[model samples]
Target: MPVDEAGAKAKGGRKRLIAIAVVAVGMLAGAGGVYWYTQRGSADHAGEKQAEAAAAEGEAEGGEGHGAADADPTASYIEVAPMMVNLRGGGAQAKFVKVRFIVVAAEGKTDAVKGRIPVILDALQPFLRELRPEDLNGSAAVFRIKEEMIRRSTAALGKGMVRDILIQDLIQQ
Candidate 1:
């Protein structure tokens, strides 16, 4: 009877040890899987960086072959004066948005676009002033703002004068 009781105790201990070992192995596997997932993302980003570097090198080589006349005339940009406007809705504290941008003009329309800077500003000021803080919350807000800027610029400068507007800085305070 004593021998049988000892044997049963040993068997129970062995089962508990096996269960602990299995749980430890499972934890190690989970950690390894997490490490692998994070490393895969970083590797993909590194590949993108390499591809961008290669493209930049290609552009540098290609640019050296071109002369002044070969350059695109509409590639010139006109800088706009920065504007600070108070936002429409802020109950207690006043909110203001400041922005600086450059205008890209259509082919042979650089002078026209430059001359209409004040008119463009006139059209843009009211539209910008009306924007609430919530209006500028997301990535889509930027796209909407750009589209509206282009529309206002075209209205001010007439059709085909303004090509695009590149926002240099946008700050909210």
Candidate 2:
């Protein structure tokens, strides 16, 4: 009877070992599938980028492209002097952010926008001073800041004067 019991125990152990091996194989297969899926996605993304680059190159060579006809060849930019403003909510140690930007003007509106630089700065100064350190956290923050600046510039210079604001430098200290 003892011999029979020992044989049964050996069979049970063997079954457990088999189950563990099957589970390990399944986990490895799942990992491999995930890796393959991620690699395939990146490859697809790379292909898309390459196609875009080719399209851009074709446009550069005078191919009929989307929005190329409407693009202005004489677009002008007005550079803003760097300004540093203290950030809000900086407890004891004063925090400041410095930014230099360029204002994109509408077609034939470069001088108009340049003339309103002081007004634009006046509109932007208070807005910049009110910004907290936390407000400049990520890329989204930068986009928000740009949009706000555009809005302010538009309000200051009237409609169709400011097209965009290109942030040349942003430093926080």
The most accurate candidate by lDDT is: 2
Compared with the true structure, what per-residue lDDT tens digits does model 1 show for residues 93-154?
68788877778778888887788899999999999999987676544555567669889989
**lDDT per residue as tens, model 2, 1-173:** 99999999999999999999999999999999999987885676455444544443443333543223225576677889998999998487687888887787888999888888999999999999999877876445655676688899999999988876766556665
Give the runs in model 1 whose Cα sits over 4 Å from its true position: 1-73
Q: What does the lDDT read for residue 10 in candidate 2?
A: 100
**Candidate 1 similarity to native, TM-score:** 0.58
lDDT of 1: 0.73
Candidate 2: misplaced stretches above 4 Å? 1-71
Provide the lowest-lDDT 10-residue window in model 2.
61-70
